[model samples]
Target: MSDANGGFRPRLRALDRRQGLAFMAALAERLRPNYLLYAEASEQGDPAALRVIHDLIWEALLVKEARIDFERQAEKLAEMEPPAEDESFGARRALEAVMALAACLDSLRGEAPEAALEVSELSRSGVQAFIELTEGEEDAQRLAALIRQHPLMDDEYDFQAAVLEAVEAPLDRGALKELRRLGRNGGVSNLGLTLD
Candidate 1:
């Protein structure tokens, strides 16, 4: 389902029993450890930790919901009959949407906020490139020409590898540490200067 702004709203009620069970399993897998820690923090009355855990749970839920949507769309597309000439473009558009959702879920897998944002940006550009690739293919001849011109279209390795490579890379803790150091050292202007 979509909201008034066209943003996705999870079709929680639309899910069948199997899909609902799968969603629940994935959600629990992602949140169980955090829930344990959240419980510990709550017992100690640590508001800050409690807040972080709450945010983590919310983020996980959003990611899981998106995964279900992507899977559902892909299944629906698979069950579709062969597209007529006019309907072909809709198939391509659906592919792009599924790609975007995959990118989002991939980004969120590790619970890394920055990586999720990066993957979202990269995925959007990837889909835009796909759109541009077919923009001038108004006929079979043009599409054939496009395929010949861009052989890499047959290969998805580059983008998929990039996304996974980036997700696997460790977060830069040094940057956060440097920011804290700067804060202690009296802000940006004093970053590299000696005050002796």
Candidate 2:
């Protein structure tokens, strides 16, 4: 199950619907703090609103009887998108977080069959952007090389692989909770940011 050249999508497609949704939800959960941090700093967007949608995703996976209004959730998620004109790195990362969550919701609604892969790529892109911003390297080729070799990027790939492995196996409520815990990564984001 290599992630090379978007190879993981076919593997994701092999999973059952619930498994795929679980995979996306886990990645989205990991990304939640990125948006929350941005929202807090910018004093825009409702952090609690985003949290509600994330909570709903986990609940839906954990409880068989739980139901989510995907369309309404998508509408709510759209409102959280950062303005395109705000091109700060934080804004970009926050936007990716929102989009990843939206992809998760879309997958649940059967609108985005590749939601898991999209979330995976978004997470990696966020890490790459962070590395490029912090490294301060103007050379595109060197920066690209650095990003491929960075520890954060390695962790991102490893984390996604672990999540996929978890979902590929049999899952129950307890396993799902464990997966969420793994995604949480002890209150850390993919870029190693922690919510204060």
Top-scoring candidate (TM-score): 2
Q: What are the clash counts of all predictions, listed in order? A: 0, 0
Model 1, 87-177: lDDT tens digits are: 3433333333233333334333433234333333333344345545546667877665564455343222233333223223332434323
Provide TM-scores for the models.
0.23, 0.92
lDDT of 2 by residue, 23-130 (tens): 888888788788888898998778899989989988888887887788999998899888888998889989988988888788778788777777888898899989
CA shift at 20, candidate 2, in angstroms? 1.4
- Which segments of model 2 are wrong by more than 4 Å? 1-9
Query: The CA-based lDDT of model 2 is what?
Result: 0.86
> Model 2 — which ten-residue stretch has the worst lDDT?
1-10
Superposition TM-score, candidate 2 onto the true structure: 0.92
Cα TM-score of candidate 1: 0.23
Q: What are the lDDT scores of the predictions, listed in order?
A: 0.33, 0.86
